[model samples]
Target: MDRSNAFVLVGAVGAGKSSLFNVLFDKEEAALKTQAVVFETGGMDTPGEFFSHPRLYNALIQTVSDVGTIVYVHDGTDRTCRLPPGMLRVYGGKRVVGAITKIDMPECDPDFAERLLRENGVNDAIFRVSSRVRETVGPLKRFLFGELSDGPHACGDVERKKA
Candidate 1:
C-alpha cells in the first residue's frame, strides 16, 4: 500500500480527530478548536464545523477522493451521533475506516461507538482507540502500516493474530 497519500479524518466537533492524527503520526499538533482544514504529514484534519454544516460536505468529498484513506472519527463519550447513517458509502472511491476516540473517557462505551460506526458504513475496518495513549491504538497503527489485515480483526477487539 502506498503510504505517501495522507489519511483524511472527518468527524463532529471535539471528536478528537486532530488528536488521533497526532497519536497516529507521533506529532504534537494540538487538537485546539479547529475552524478550518489543517493538513499534516500523514493526515488531513478537518474542523468539526465542516460536519456541522451541509454546504461543506462537497469539500469533504473532494478531499476524500484525493487521499489514500478516509478515517471517520466518533466521540465515544458522546452517545449522540452526528453523522447520517451509512455515510461512509459517500466516499466509496476511497478506503474508509472508523475510529472511536476518547475510549478512556469517563462516559465512553467503545462497544456502542463501534456499533454506531458499523451501522454508519465503515466497511473496511473499525478501530476503537483513545488518542491519549498511542499504544492503545496498536491495531490502527498496524493497519495504517499495512501490517494488519483489514478484516474482522480490524475491529480492534482482539489482538491481531500473527500470520
Candidate 2:
C-alpha cells in the first residue's frame, strides 16, 4: 500500500464514516459496529475496531498529512453537520473532500450540510453519500482520487470531479 496516496476519513461520531469506509474499500467490517457510531471505509488490509472519541481532529491531521486525500465524513441527518473546530484549525485550507453520509436517513439535509461547510470556510469539494448503498460511495471516491489527485500545493486541482 502506498501511504503517500491514501485516503483519510474524518467526521463527527455516528456520522457513518466507518460505514462509508467499508463500502468504498469493499470490506464488510472495516470498522467496529456499535449502536451509534460507524467507521469510514478504506483499502486498509487490516481493519481495526472502532472507538469513539472527541480527538478525531488529531487523527484526521495525522491521516491527511500522511495520505494524499482526506475524506471528511459528516452526518447529514444531524442538523449540526459543521466541521469540528479542531479539524478546521488543522485542515482549514487543505484539500478535503467532504462527504455527507447517511443520506437514507430521514433527517439528512444536503443544503444544511453544504451551508455548514461554507460557514466553516470549507471551500473545497464536497459529496453527499449514503454508506448503506454501494452506488453513492463511487462519486466520493472518484472526486477524491480523480479530480483532487494533485498535490495540495498544486493550482487548478481543486475542481470537483464530474460524474
- Taking every candidate in turn, the Cα RMSD to the unseen true structure, in Å, is 5.7, 7.7
- Expressed as tens digits, the lDDT of each residue in 39-154 for candidate 1 is 76667788887788888878776667667787888988777778855556774567788888876666777888878777677767778887766677788877866778636544
Q: What is candidate 2's TM-score against the reference?
A: 0.67
lDDT of 2 by residue, 1-163 (tens): 4555556665655677667776776777655643332333332211111223444444445545555565666677677754646554564445566777666666566768768866765567777777666676676666655643543321111223233
Mark the 10 consecutive residues where model 1 has the least summed lDDT: 154-163
Best by TM-score: 1
For residue 123, model 1's alpha carbon misses the true position, in angstroms, by 1.8
lDDT of each: 0.74, 0.57
For candidate 2, the 10 contiguous residues with the lowest summed lDDT are 42-51
